[model samples]
Target chain A: MGSNDAVRKVHRHPERQRVDRDALYRLLDEELVGHLAMVVGGEPLIVPMAYARVADALLLHGSTGGGFALRAATEGHTVAFSVTALDGIVVARSLFDHSMNYRSAVVYGELETLGPAEEDAALIALSERLLPGRPSEVRANTRKELAATRVVRLPLADAVFKVRDAGPGEAEDDGEDHHVWAGVVPARRGWGAPVVSALTEPDAPLPPSVRRLIEVPG
Target chain B: MGSNDAVRKVHRHPERQRVDRDALYRLLDEELVGHLAMVVGGEPLIVPMAYARVADALLLHGSTGGGFALRAATEGHTVAFSVTALDGIVVARSLFDHSMNYRSAVVYGELETLGPAEEDAALIALSERLLPGRPSEVRANTRKELAATRVVRLPLADAVFKVRDAGPGEAEDDGEDHHVWAGVVPARRGWGAPVVSALTEPDAPLPPSVRRLIEVPG
Candidate 1:
């Protein structure tokens, strides 16, 4: 629940910054994808990657032959992974104070490429994270398939979470008219109908994991 | 309508790589936020920023005082700005092929801080992007408010766009079961009911911008 190093402290919005470890873990677990960024060729390069939180580390899915994440892992560069969720819109009387309610976290760490037993464990963890309770419903990955995928893990030792969940901010005697509309409009993400593939049998039932996800309201 | 240089080209999935300028412009215009990142102190630093596209450049909103983006602008670092939209989940027959249907773009370039007249225009563009028709319904920003904000612009010259909008991918003779249910689960984002501030009159009519945004279904 304490601060990381001085270099990664949240300075811009001190009020919104959170130092709790649970906040960091919760943010990582709730989001399915994140932006992984690193400097390459003297310019910043960032790409969205699918990730899963397993304990205190992040398992990033990377293709052995093509993924830039793999290159970052090979180079042992300190990478940044960012996850953000937009909560709502904060409407204010003045445009200057208009803001978005959101929760964001940025983690700074070096990615280590996993091998052998750890790689299989990371892949299984990633699968469960993406589709809970479905690992048993699926077949095991062939050796060739496993060999083509590279799993990289980043320890969650240095991260910062910032959240803005309240209503619009108004300054004291800001001189704006009182007869204006100001409030918040909540935003959310939801899953639509599960589309069965045309090739699959029409009567095949939906997987339990998929059923539970859509049945529960977001 | 052409590709960028080799260093910034999309080599991972050439089929998903889009060279059309309209596609790149549409993706940037549709998204309200992006992750701006650079290598600072030999570590990657990224922050989520509200941005808008005007012509061929991105205008990012940042605090002039404590924002890391402001520091990046002052340092003249070649920053990376990434925007991604997760359209849906492609539920394959096997977890090996499971993937997310998404459109992602990573732009490599430098951020230039806007000047007097351009700053005003950039601010307006950003406001319109975040909330359409909002500027007309709100009061103009004060001189001090304007001075405290910094708007950084990044050209869309060196960029790459990749999109996966299809259903599950199945390999020929991959030795997988035929009876498993597999398809795409569509995902969507929506806005909830607007909560009017308690301070405002209960019967205060909603602004035209707010009314239009929520009334229309996503």
Candidate 2:
């Protein structure tokens, strides 16, 4: 589909549609998970997936077992991948006007399975994106593990990005009282103190990557 | 579908499947937004929507515009509504096993549009759920506003709930070194301080509902 084709256009609220390519990349880069929807056996199946944006494509990897990603790639079925960040709760004087502040992007396309040669690089990119500054610190993936994983890529060409970042919209003549408190309660995701695993050595220091992740703001 | 039917069962990881009805309700109740997926002209359209779970059904309301929810309801199409809560980020020594702690529920059913008589109560339930303890504080919805809103309900039956709530699972025989620090970094959603709207009266005291929301830990 074309970039601005009617099929991918935002029809519900035309005002919230965003066409900037950078905005779409920023949203994809920031979110850790996405919901993947595809038609399976004539029934729509939506599954939460861990994904990373690599260049112009989204990289998704799953085990070789009954994996949705593997099935979709093998069948060349069209899928819709959506990433949504709920920013806040918009409290309005009227219930009808109350809403949520959010940024969402939905991409539609068929996923292509990566070949064995490219799978290793894609896996490294996914790891680096999910756990920044750690790919070098950890041991490389073994061939057995790599063979059991399925990696797929979906391009970001046909996508729609919509954002509602402002506070509640209230009209002057809505008839609701003006004295009521109305605004936005921002919702944010933050990382708590990391808990060391049970099998870790007693004196193992916190990795620099984990430390940096804690220092960074979401 | 039966509670544990093959279609509703969590095939990939049967261990994470939660069969309790109360667990499904709790997950839906805690989450404020859900991804609604419906097939439109043979293409899957997934939209993040503000939703509230009442008793045995989810209440969703949208404007009379080209809203997907309204279209799905009007056409009596089958839709899948999914709610996911990311509890924590799992930091594992093995890139292959890295995962996120989360609770997700997907309900598959045809949406039923509520009649005018039931729309009012559904809207109130939605408002109360989103901004708890606020419906009584604000004025009731005006007739004009209610007339322009479309509400639909989807039952909680035929739903699947999956949860992953533990630290990273590691095998003793695994080749990865045990010296690395690996565990979970809890991810949580919290409300920031409320910012009063521009049209609100100056020095309008924070509503009790807003105050309560701030006090409650997410």
Q: What interface RMSD does every candidate have? A: 3.2, 3.2
For model 2, residues A1-218, the per-residue Cα lDDT tens digits are 53324555666778888898998899999888788877655556677777889889998765211274357435766788899888888899888788888888989888887889999888888888777977887778889879977888889878878888887888643666778889999986778889888888888889988899888865
The positional error of residue B214 in candidate 1, measured at the CA in angstroms, is 2.0
In candidate 1, which residue pairs clash? none
TM-score to true structure, per model: 0.93, 0.93
lDDT of model 1, residue A114: 87
Candidate 2, residue A8: the lDDT equals 56
* Tens-place lDDT digits, model 2, residues B1-218: 42213444565878887888988888888888888876666666677787889889988665212274457545766778889888887778887777788888889888888889898998899899888988898888888877878788888877878889887888732867888888888886778889889888997899999899888875
RMSD of 2: 2.6
Number of colliding residue pairs in each model: 0, 0
Q: For model 2, what is the alpha-carbon lDDT of residue A169?
A: 86
Chain B, model 1, TM-score against the native?
Answer: 0.91
Candidate of highest lDDT: 2
Where does model 1 sit among the CAPRI classes? medium
TM-score for chain A, prediction 1: 0.91
